[model samples]
Target: MKKKMMVGGLLPALVLSTCGLAGAQPVAMDTLTAMEQNPDAGSQMRASTEPVTQESLQEMRRQLEEQLQQAQELQNRLNAQLGSLEKRMKKVEKKSWEPPVEIHGYGRLRWDKHRYEDRNDPNDYKTIWLNLFTKYRINDRWALHSEHEFENNLTTNHGAYEGQGGYNEPGGKKYSRPVLQLYAEGRVGEVNVKAGRYYLQSPYKFTFDDKIDGWQISYGIPTKWGRKANFTLSAGNTYSKIFYGDKENESNYWNEGGDGNLKVVSLIGEIPVAKNTNLAMHYGKIKRRNDRLERKTWSIGFDTKINRDLKFWAGIAKSDSQTLNKSHFLQLQYKEARPDIPGSYDIYIKKYLQRGHSGMTNWFNDDIAEFTHGDYKEENIANNGNDKVFQYSRWGEFNGLRIGVDFVPTRNTKLLINYTFGKMGKCLDKDPGRRYDYSFFRTQWEMYF
Candidate 1:
């Protein structure tokens, strides 16, 4: 009986110890041994430990479940944050590959009047001009640019009885359908390059508006004074109705049978000589097909700031020609007109003396002597008595004074007034006894967008 009771007690204690070990808290070995030695004591101890163990396990399990749910929630929040960051990174990467584009331009309305000393009639006209410019940045160092122009003369009636058949009549509007300038520009280190149809502004070539189909390369030179200096080389062929005439006309030298082109090669340089001053030089050669006509031109000039609000420029130009081969100019300006600032104003005065051969085309004042008579038409003077015959060729010898004022009355809008007066040079009339005086007045309103 005693052996059987001992065995039974040991078996119960072993089972209880095993069950306790599987729980979060284990039973003590001393308590298990004590329970094994007494049957009644073991039964009482089991009854007492059972309720406490069951409640403690239930509390522990509840805590563990709560901790597990919190851990899972924290993990989900981290994943959501990580996903948001990844999406932002992807958006930034996509933006880096897209190019930027810009578009802007201006509109202008102008009134022009021409008066001659010997003629009773005055030429008056009005015109509208529109320009559109666009730029696209392909990358950090490469870009593309384009400009388009449209022009129309609004003064169609010269006089009620003068008829409607004239150069400024209806259907005489002018425009460049595709583009006035289209070019690719890029920069590599200190070197810059431009190719395709673009504007060329040189001393002896087109001043500002004419376009050439070719290329230009410029280098930024390093100087000891840390000033700005540049050297440029350009080669191109100029084709414009203003200078070359229409294709059907015989004067369209670039398209006709005479070598099919007028070529121009030019070198220009700007050197900083002092503070707020620069010395400029230019050399250009113009060659026609078959070597029919070749002209070598050179110019030297200097631009300086007299004060914070005053500036001056003077230059002399010469060409290798037997007749009419000299030109000089002096300009002084005060202040500057800022288009963005209302009530801003600038005033300037310029004096220029140009010979026919010196500047093949005077871009600034091409129409200074457009209505003057040349010596070849002297026979008409006897019959008309001071009546003038129009000069077909626009480029000729003339000396003139130009005064201008530019004022901005509102943001992005400008008003300009200019007056010019001059006398014909020897190339226009060989007779020193006769005087061909002319005056011009122009007023323009421009709005920028």
Candidate 2:
């Protein structure tokens, strides 16, 4: 009875395990048919279709065992692989990299030479100028910028100097000097404030500020057209180191130190005329104050791109100086793109009219001041024969003309050639009679990276 009970339970358990509860119980129809066919058949025979054979049962059990073992092994292998992958992912996620900071600067150098046929002097000179710039970004909202420049040139026959190579001779009209610029600037919403020493120049316009060093505040407000427009209002002071006067408190008519303190104010704008085309306008005033003279100057200018191949620019300015009397300027410029080459060429011309006051003309220095003064000015305070030299060159009025061309080969290289023509209404030299006419041509080549 014990063996029989064990057999019955094992058969049902195997069936249930292989299929489900339904497979554990065969239908009564099969049992009844089996019983009808063989009434003596025992419960063992009725439990299933045929008799249970030891080898067949053993083979089925072996297959089931093998499959279970394989499933467990596969699960273990997958878990190991998953753990390794998780470790690799953690390592990758922990790695970090930093952004790099870079510093760069550029300048220009040239070998300038000229051969003049006049007097067979064959004057030759070399020119070289170096400018360095540095920019640093503290963050998205803060930046620092600065530039320093040093330049030198050889000068000869520059008429401004008399008696070749004197101790105080304008130093060949070339000298090395430090131009310092340091500023902190960033955009505050739509307005920007820049404070500290900076170089300022008007675009589409020219201002006395171009020659002076000062600080400025610029605001860049947005316009309604989705285009960017900004106006710059600036004030700065400029003065020449070459001051002339016998005494600090004394003022002279022909001296430079009396009122050379240059002050300037400007309003300039950058506006878009079209997609790739822009318009610029500038209006500004420069004032000079000193013991002897105070001057007021105004300038207005316009610059625009007419098309892809053409550009137009024009400006007019007027000045009233205590020492210079009255001065005026007119300028016109045009640029045409050369389609055949990679470089562009441009040309500009300017005409100037200036009335120099009597005491403002520079004709004699300390050595000749005693002797040449009488010949240079209408009345020499020192009473010297230099007044006679002034009779031929000083016209009481001076006019000048400048014409120039610029060629740009790339973003970093440029070539400029300019000619300045000057005329004096008053004569200080006998050879030119009562009028003086002369021209100076200068060529500059620049490169940077």
Candidate 3:
């Protein structure tokens, strides 16, 4: 019976392959008759009553086992071939395997033209500067970054300082030139160690005037809650030309030990609240040893999405310039549309208030200039024949406001317009050169890739 069953199942394949199926009429009739008697019966019936032989039973078992083994082998081969084809398809399309390394940078050929509306001195000049940046990535785990900046105010013809006295250049003249970024970083485990001259994002403000030449170590990590956190500690001297000491001749850089050394530590954290909303906070302390000047500041900020087309942010900051003094700053921002939209607009407003002296000395005095590496050494820190430490209204006016707008027409192009107003304690008003209300406007464009 078993042999008959085995032979019956194989008959269909044999008939279909070699018998031209149409000529197998007798076999089809036999198959139908056997199926009617036993639904699973074979097309070729053997003598079932012959007392089934052991050899025949063994043969049927062997054939079924062979067919099963063959079917499994064919299945494995097909799976392997399908896998190879999929791999080739992935190779043909980008973004399939590991992500590729990418590097990008941005720069601004800035030109600031001002007309001294309140004339202690009436003058109009255009100052130009160029900033360049570049970066490289070796793989997912390592990267190299650099930025070079050069500035030459062709109208004033001084890069380091707009004034007459500066470090002599090779051409028997003084001029500012390009400066190197001079920093390298490597990642190990979860920490990134960096060494060399680099830019510090201080809590005081975000501008070139506050950037210092220094070496720093920084690390960042994301918490289980998905918040981003960062920490940094750095030590460096103030720039040259700033004054320090009880007398003019004793003046020098802060780290040279005339007054003392300069140091700074900072931390920042950011958390996401919604798809387009976030919260941010920052804290930092700056120490000046030689002149006994110290500063600590902190800020808290939040960004919220009002709708698909609008976003807003607000922040408040407080600062302690020394042990007994305090200052405050507040800012607000609103975006009409994102950079994805042509002619999209952004607006920002800021206010600043200081109750006590903002550094050791208020005005840009010769000593303060030399002490802090004053790039604007001749800006005059003294209160014009007065010992008021700070000009009465300039540093003491306890109040200032700023408003700005950004218009982006494309992904790589932008326009910025801003205005500022404050009371200079001792700066003069136009009529008699007496310090009074102050206001100014600035406009610029930037391109990047």
Candidate 4:
């Protein structure tokens, strides 16, 4: 008998196939002879089996080892590709952050007129006021913010006593440039810090309270309900030094311990009420170096909305001159939900009141006199060229009433019309049983950029 072996294919699997076997159909004698011959490598004679060969076993083992090595090489290639992809993803994430510089601003042009019995040189002027804000972010927790304002009476441009009866020499069309806010803001742990020149917050908002030039510290915590509980404290200048007479002082800022400056400090806090509503409480005291309230004031109020259309706002402030102060505001407004939608429209009506003895507080962003409290109106309203008696106000001292309308015809423009009527509770010193009523109308076109 003879033994036959197969070495037709180099691959392990195909080397064991029997599809090309030599005997397909044989005669009886031939079949007997084939059965008698040793079967091909994948088969054996029925009566006996061929012994395994050491050399054939070694070849099979070698092929298996080669296949293992190829699989490992393929796996290494896949891992290398995966590592490169991960590195690229990390780099892209680092580049995708908020912009480092920002700019925004708002401007308004107003045609304001005040008329009363026997008024000379009608108090009418179309004034343009613009404010621009910019910010540069240094990092995740630090930034520099700067804001400036410009005002043009469209007739003359100079720094004059801007209050009542103020004067600007009629000359060229120029604007007054004033820096409103410039500050470096950052955070250390949970505490927020601000330094440089910025408006000192007085309760809700006070313009004449004077800008502070010092440092501030603040903090806030956010709740799951989307409201933040916040507190702020600030220190800066109020009224500065005194340089009176032969006392060798060049200014009249009392309690300036040789620094020729005065210090004012303020503390304010806010508490969340509900969705889109909150209460703010604030206290501010201007101290002489001797530690007395040179100009002290406080404010606490609630500003909220109902059904997203109607709003109720009320607040009060008290100072040495503004005692028993009070204020109230209510408005019904309808505006487009967002800027992109085409059907954008806004119309609103508002009512405001401030009355009582020294009943006054300052509302910044408001140029209307009836809404102003204390001396801010007394000084500025007269400059509108109105009768001194006509300046009677419900401002922090007298009783006042205001009605205003705001309408938006376009996405970026708004028109505002407001009227204020006021009367003092007591008689004017110059006149007996004074019954002078004060009122004015202002029309404004406002835009944002």
Candidate 5:
């Protein structure tokens, strides 16, 4: 019986292999038929008992296809993530304040009192002064600025007696307070271009501090000393003959109608000298600007700082003068404005000379000119129709010296005191003249923010 059962189980496997009817794995069909007759067959069923049907095969194929699709989707997601990470790693960043705008201004207020020695004249007087300025920076290379000045007690009552009615008070008219500067500037390449009415503080600050009406071009190279070596070429109106101390007190050079002779040219330079110091040089020319003044002016000057607290300035210039005659000026200054100190101070001394037709040009200089014709020397200080002192505003054949000090109790406040002494020339007429000795005292107070 055992031999017959073994033969019976082997017959179907051999027949299936011969016919090649099974797919991957051959099934024992004869043995399976024999098992159906046994009572224990149900307990020996395999995990995959049925032969593979078309429906089952299709289901298996569908499952494989889904798994392949899922793997492909996962691979594509990894590739996208890698690309995004590479982009983030390769990118850069930038800054915020590429272009900019700004604003700033400074101003001052002052009082002055002056008198003359050895002259029995009504020359002692009181005065007040004020000025304001504004600046606007439009861009990195462009800017604009404006300045205005107001004054009182600029006129004097020369003809009136004590307690009598005369011209004594200030001419406080709207037009009297003139704009000292109004300008616009921009940089193109290495050169800066500026246009409009502006103040001219030439080398030495000795020859002039007048308002100029026109344009300028400048260039500069920076140095180790913090100051720049710069060059400036400018053209504008200069030196208009008028009395700033008289009733008309004319100072405007721009809108007074064009004078063919009013135009002038200037070349100026600032060169580095030492740490916290610089050297300044200037050359300027003024053409004949009026019917009464058919002449020209050419000037030269230099200024330098010796240390952080010491400086010197000087100039020798000629204007409608005799041969070998020239105008001369010299100044020495000491200053200390420390960042850690609230109290700062400056002391300065100056000598001046205006002879041989140097002319009266620097009207808006640091000091005021004499107002009366009777008190002025031949080189007038206030040149109205009356032979006055505009010519001698700074100096003349007469010896002149001035000393001043500026005291600061805080960052925004200052006090100034100045004294001037002058001696008259020997050749001056005796009629409207007082004496050879002249002197005065002036004081000013200023505040700014």
Candidate 6:
């Protein structure tokens, strides 16, 4: 009887141990002692007890070993997963500390046909331009940008006036070498600043295509109406031969001109006058070192959006010079060409009445104001000149109409076609007979990366 009781107790203890190993509640030591000391407790368990054998004990031991092995395998897998997650987190932290850089630009191919009333044959030429732009972000508050341009003329003969004297070469003008265009730009608080070689767009003093060597500062004005307003000041020397002098001269540097050092200062302001409309004003002063000729220029204009897809702009510019002192323009545009959207297009019409002195440099669209050397002549009224006939070459007087269409066939690709027809004459010429009729046509294709 004693042996049977002992086996019964041992069997219960083994069952409890197995349950504990399988993550169940463990039997307390006091409960085990009570079961052993109390006769009633023994009697309660006696009916449920079974005979204990060596085979049964071996089977329980084997099950416990297998459970322990599974738990160890699970712990190993969890440890490996944690290690992989830690590695990915370290990689993300490294990337957050590095600076960012970007590179992009565009290439253009253009064909031009120019016809003057006095010339017997039209001049046709083709040009190719490649521009490279780079940007580096030093931090959230500061960054740097640079642009380089390469221009090449593909037409060798250049039509009838092939050997005529011109700016770069007698046969044809070409810029085969790369030239640095824009250098740096940054922002400080509410002010934006630019340095090195850059371009400006103003009514009288500068156009969008004119390159200048200098610096610029601009600030935005806060308004209660949530309208846009800004003030800009720029001072620089002309860096291209297109600015008021011999077109053939290699004056692609600072303060380089045919006459002497040429410098310019310009101030511009835009104030919101109405919904989707703004009043624009500009003041510019240009001075030449050798001749001491100082020209003061100013303009007032307004631009407005007639509707969602239509816009209009008109402005008048005046100069203090005796000749070429007045100019005005009106423009209307329908739709807009978006480079990122395929099948996008725009159409525009512009009317211009410009005097030579009114624009210190050529207009942004060269086809609108085509200037030919020795084509228009005026009597020397200044009296300081040695020649009796003053040959006007740069931005000579012209009144014209220009119409253009810009289309995008695919993303980052654009096609442009424009035509200009007008009458051009000597600067400040009052005689209507001296004016000659002219026409210009141009087509351009561009691709961006």
- Residue 295, model 3, lDDT: 59
For residue 274, what is the lDDT in candidate 3?
Answer: 57
Local accuracy of candidate 5 as per-residue lDDT tens digits, 1-449: 56445545553455445344323222433443444455355443322243334464355445544544565677699999999987765542111332133333444444454544544763555545556677676765888888876544534422212111233333111122167788998999999999998877676554445678899999999888877799999888753442222212224322222233466677888887777555666666655444333334455656677777888877776654332135677889999544235688889998886442343345324554443222233343454656554332222343578899888887777777898777533222222133357666777666665
RMSD to native for every prediction? 14.2, 15.9, 9.6, 12.2, 18.2, 11.3
Task: Output the number of the TM-score-best candidate.
Answer: 6
lDDT of 3 by residue, 1-449 (tens): 77756766664464343334334545544554454456334323544423334565455445544554565677699999999999888766534544343344554544433223244752333445556666565555665667767655555566644343334532222333245564666777877766665666543331112344565666766655465556666556543211222112233422222232455555655666556667776766655565545555666667677776455656555555322234455666676635556778878787765332233222221111111122111233466766434222222232467788888888767787776666533311211233346555566667666
Candidate 4 vs candidate 5, TM-score winner: 4
The candidate that wins on lDDT is 6
lDDT of 1 by residue, 170-282 (tens): 32212223477999999878789999888777742323235678999999777765786899898887642222221223444332112326677778898988888888888
List runs of model 6 lying over 4 Å from the truth. 1-99, 157-177, 203-209, 240-260, 363-365, 369-395, 428-433
lDDT of 4 by residue, 230-312 (tens): 89998876322111111222243222122325676788888887887788877766554643324455667777776666666
Candidate 1 error regions (>4 Å): 1-99, 157-178, 203-209, 224-226, 240-260, 363-395, 426-433
Tell how far residue 32 is off in model 2, in angstroms: 53
Location of the lowest summed lDDT over 10 successive residues in candidate 3: 365-374
| Candidate 5 backbone clash number | 11
Worst 10 residues of 2 by lDDT: 363-372
Q: Provide the TM-score for each candidate, comma-separated.
A: 0.66, 0.53, 0.59, 0.61, 0.58, 0.67
Checking candidate 1 for backbone clashes, the offending pairs are none
> What is the C-alpha local distance difference test score of each model?
0.66, 0.49, 0.49, 0.54, 0.56, 0.67
lDDT score, candidate 6 = 0.67
lDDT of 2 by residue, 269-321 (tens): 77765564455665555444544333344545455556654555555444443
Comparing 2 with 3 on TM-score, the higher-scoring candidate is: 3
Better of 1 and 3 by lDDT: 1
Query: What is the lDDT, from 0 to 100, of the residue 418 in candidate 2?
Result: 75
Q: What is the lDDT of residue 111 in candidate 1?
A: 90
